[model samples]
Target: MPVPRNSKTTGSKQLRPGKAGAVENARPEKEESCQAKRSPSSPQGAPKKRSAFGDLTNAHKNQAGLRKKDATKAGPRKAQKGTAALGVLKNNEINLKKATRKTPPDEASAEPKLVPKNDPVLEEPAPVQAPAIEDIDKEQLGDAYASAEYAKEIFNYMKEREEKFLLPNYMEKQYDISRDMRAILVDWMVEVQENFELNHETLYLAVKLVDHYLVEVVSMRDKLQLIGSTAILIASKFEERCPPCVDDFLYICDDAYKREELIAMEMSILRTLKFDINIPIPYRFLRRFAKLLPLPWSQCAHASMETLTLARFICEMTLPEYDYVQESASKLAASCLLLALKMKSLGGWSPTLEYYSGYSSHELHPLVKRLNFLLTYQHDDKLKAVRTKYSHRVFFEVAKSAPMDMLKLEVALKS
Candidate 1:
């Protein structure tokens, strides 16, 4: 049937089956087109067109490249971890190789090198050797005394102890005693010592006790004799094997002190000195050095005895002189021995003497000259007890020896 041109039913009547299917498809296409137009109103629609400048911008290009790079990197992450571990191992291998490589000789020679060869520039130093026991014993004995390996040790020990008992200055100031009065006391003590036949060590120690006691205590002149007597009494007991009885001391002092007074002074001195009575004296050192004198025994026995007597006289003379309190016993001994050698026309000071005495002749010259002056110049007749003691024949009459001339002493010293 023919359809009317403007009627929808007529148009439907003119449609074939194929045409009808096409019409239905056409309706869906129109619906889709309407939906596409509505989608532009939403935010998630098709991209807007870019400007010319935006297409040339580097930020978008860089972002695109980064995205490509991140995509590529994502696939190799596990392999990249293995490769990083390989690189660290390679670095460790290189460090070990460097550490194990031997240094070249040219580089080693740049530093100080110890070589066993005898080349003067590279020779090693020799090791030090300790002194032999025999050498030490010889040195300790000083070629004179009995061989005592520990003599040097003993001397050093005594030297350390000497500092403790060093007599202080102003010793006489603490007492009513003058230097002259002390000298008189020492002279009388010497006489008493001889009368009692006491050892010379006892006499020296007694003087030390008196001096040390006087330094700590004040006393009247009347009590000075008592103090001296008590000192002698105490020293005798300590240094003597068979000390005299108390009655003997009283008899020597002509009954000047009773037994009780003697005992009291002894206790007072011991208290003041704290019972430390062992003190070094010049007499001991003098005797020790005198034994070292190289005398010509072939000529006569009197030669050795005379030299020792002169040296002893000089040492005893120093004891009464208060100015010599500071002089060490060893030094005084050396000086007196040297002067005795010179006075007797024996050989002058030598290296052997220096080694034993521990002092050089140059160091001993001044002391030697002072001793000569002491012998030659009569300063005090009253202080001549030491001289008178030696003037007798029993003491070798060393005090009767010819006076030493200054010119002769000067010549001897220069040589």
Candidate 2:
């Protein structure tokens, strides 16, 4: 309370509760508080959770920006999934998010809501009654066999026409597989089939494309084989996994199918398919429907191979679109095995189809049986001649001549 040096020291510099410097500093703090305390309606920088009725336009935009930030913060994989899901949500008509809101039934409806708790209406619809397979015969299938038979005829004619005339013309037009080089190209295609386990569809498509390219483009002679081999290589890649590498194929051919051949063929074929390698094959569909019917593995494998064999037949033909691979496969399998049965004069139903076929544990499809019989009578010698013409073809080889085991498996399943 006492000034040590002089009383003037205390009076001259008297302290003040509110100094100008303090007031100036306080102004910024007050402004910050006011800024903090403003309106509740103003959106903070934080992202609001997306809701059912959120503004789609703005929501998408904000979500997109947040995604970029999150991607950088989280990782790339999440960002990719988010982007894919975004596309699916925007365009996926069938997979839209389920509506959360549920309406009360009593509010409105033409029909009564709850068939009273104890009423007959409350009873569940009588258990669905599907007839046993024995009761549901092929006659009930109505012309299914006929359709398959007709389809086969069309495909057979198509192959013959495509190969003898159309293929050469196509080669002349598309890839210029000159007459001399055509043989080599054909050989390479066969090699590809053996090497890649490629179905007939891919093989034929590649061959057709190569032929078309040769006919249309006037490439140098030295590069002709390359064009064919490469077409097959890439076609394999598009159609299957574990496709051989350019170098591996080069080695496989003992360097006959060289690197240049592969590279050239890739471009030539890509151009021919118009870059659309998404052509459908029958295997996928056969698997799906076969699951519903319950055919055995022996039958399935036989069916698979037979269907594969049919792909060869179809590849050589031009009657129907290749997109019908599944339909053709199913029919071919049912038919080929059916024929095998008729030749042996096998008969009777199996439990597998005693339910469906009503025959003892032995019969396969009747139509197939009829087809076999008809084929035997119709092509006693013609089969050899047709095979002779198409023997050198890439996708025309028959994998198995007899499918007895598959038939037995089919019969066993019925039991």
Which has the greatest TM-score? Answer: 1
Candidate 1 lDDT over residue span 1-415, tens digit each: 1112244333222211110001111112222222112112222232233322224568988999999999898879978997987787687997646644655567677555454355765433442232211132443233222325455565556556667777876554756678888788888887766544466678888988988888788888889888988899898788765577777667656667789999998899998899988877776666555545676444654677678778878888877888777777778888998899999888887655666567888898899898888888855777666777778766767888875898999898888
Off by over 4 Å in 2: 1-188, 195-227, 252-258, 292-415
**Candidate 1 displacement at residue 319 in angstroms:** 1.9
Weakest lDDT window of 10 consecutive positions for candidate 2: 18-27
Give each model's clash number: 0, 40
How well does model 1 score by local distance difference test? 0.68
Q: By TM-score, how accurate is candidate 2?
A: 0.35
lDDT of 2 by residue, 190-302 (tens): 54453343444456556655655655567776666566567666666665434556774564444665566577667766776577544333222222222223334344544
